[model samples]
Target: MHNIPIRNLSARLVDPFQREYYYLRLSITDVCNFRCNYCLPNGYQPHPERDKFLNVDEIRRVVRAFAAMGTEKVRLTGGEPTLRKDFVEIVENIADMENIHTLALTTNGYRMAKDVAAWRKAGITSINVSVDSLNSRQFHRITGEDKFDDVMRGIERAFDVGYQKIKINSVLMKDYNDGELAQFLAWIKHRPIQMRFIELMQTGEMDHFFQRHHLSGQLLADKLVQQGWQLQPKGRTDGPAKVFSHPDYQGEIGLIMPYEKHFCTSCNRLRVSAKGKLHLCLFGEEGTDIRDLLQSDNQQLLLQARLFAALQGKREHHYLHQGDSGVRTNLASIGG
Candidate 1:
């Protein structure tokens, strides 16, 4: 229903640094089923309070405010967003927004084979699935799940259902899947998939694991460049991945190196936790609660005002390089 001109809406989301945010990462839930070694190694623990995640109405209010303020892309994320019974309804609600041109999902691929077609019908424009390793055993070891075949089938199902291109996210770790770059590249050579190698990031609860397995994404990026993969320019709402393409292959490669210098200068996205907290930075301090203002559709102006005021406090860059992970205990908590 927001018929506001794009030019006017764009100015409202700009921060003091003059960076305009057009992307929003909204987490729908924090309960994940998989126990990834680097993230929720012990699986998701139910909070004592059992806090309720944002309902459909709340989600609509949040999306409405952001869309009205020039957010063109909205990504539905979670510890496992598909776990929600109303997941499809959530997608439809956001898809109904006229201002949101891109509706994406970041999933673990556990449900892709069975639910992807339904997801596509509900309006997910893009999909990114986490595939830590190509090897079945290695994937099981890294993710603590024995669903490698299931995930692979899910990818195939996505393509069979008309998805032209899919993005695969792999978290690179030392002595782990780090040696499988060539294997990954070869697999994606003829496929329309973007294989993204994400550097293992340090979090408060996983410092020991991070220290043991952290691998630099730059190594992979440099290797790709040397192999004739040309770097591609990023879109305004693109994530931090440095994408590269090769003339000989139908696929592409993306490197997400958070440790690299000037990593946050091109930031165009903001994150909101499943419980309605606004996170200025992925590795920043505690989030600012914006849920109170999301109670009603009439709170749109106040919500936007709170968002603009909060954006001013966003630091230019995260202190991840200085061994500071801020208050984030795990990536799944904030839908990272």
Candidate 2:
């Protein structure tokens, strides 16, 4: 499937500011199994109206609409996408689209052992596994679950299935996993997986969470350098990671500092929530409701027009830490 030739869209999809968006983060469900402290805290209730979410056919048509507008890649996210009953079907259908060049998955890795091979067969080219803490006790504390061993098994299965580009996404918090930096660096010394450390962002209930626990990726990298780890720049870039490789390590280490806002400059992706809202920025509360357009009389034409209008109104950057700006809903609902 990697050999599938590319084709150009008749009309390119460009934002009002002239930024070409070629990436789409499509969330299939808002239901998840694990509740991470920063994302879904205790007593968090799931979105009750499951019937309101788009079904398989609606998802296919919506993906095609985005693909037709020059969306080169689609990354499936969720509260946990594997929690979707039709996860395989949804992924395969999107993978079958001719205009979409790549399909990816961002999962909690709780079900990777059972689903990774099927996802790979369905044309998923890359994966991001959320593993906040390597220590089982810390993992349970951070994610409100005792599934650290399960996640480890999932990662092993993903690797055994030949996913060389597996990325481990760790959300760094000062009082939490911040001290695990050395442990993570050592863990990647002989593995092929890329370790990406992300600075905790002020999202949802985590708005106040970051002020106390936020950890800087720059500080971590600088610490690694001070500890005598040689860091060299890696060629090529994808998504928002700042990639670096150590001479003695087999895997690369990456940093994503959302607070610094460096990644916003080359922002090329848009997000579609499970409820069919097109969110131009991760921190935006308001979005154009594309679900209604998808169910309308002339979906194709209407979807095209609605998407353009949404993109035209897209914010240039998210103001999460400043003023009173930031999304109000939990990350699960917004598919972060």
Task: Identify the leading candidate in terms of lDDT.
Answer: 1
Q: What TM-score fits each model?
A: 0.97, 0.91
Candidate 1: C-alpha RMSD after superposition: 1.6
lDDT of each: 0.91, 0.79
Clash counts per candidate, in order, are 0, 0
For model 1, name the residue pairs that clash. Answer: none
Per-residue CA lDDT of model 2 for 162-227, tens digit only, reads 888689999988888987877888889899878988877776566688688987788877876776
* Alpha-carbon runs more than 4 Å astray in model 1: 1-11
User: Which tens-of-lDDT digit does each residue in 1-336 have in candidate 1?
Assistant: 334433344336888899999999999999998999999999999889987999998998898888878899999999999999999999998796867999999999999999999999999999999999999999999899999999999999999999999999999999889889889989999999999989899998999989999988877877888999999999998988999999999999999999999999999999999999999999997989999998876677788888999999989899999999999989998899
The true-versus-predicted C-alpha distance at residue 278 of model 2, in Å, is 0.2
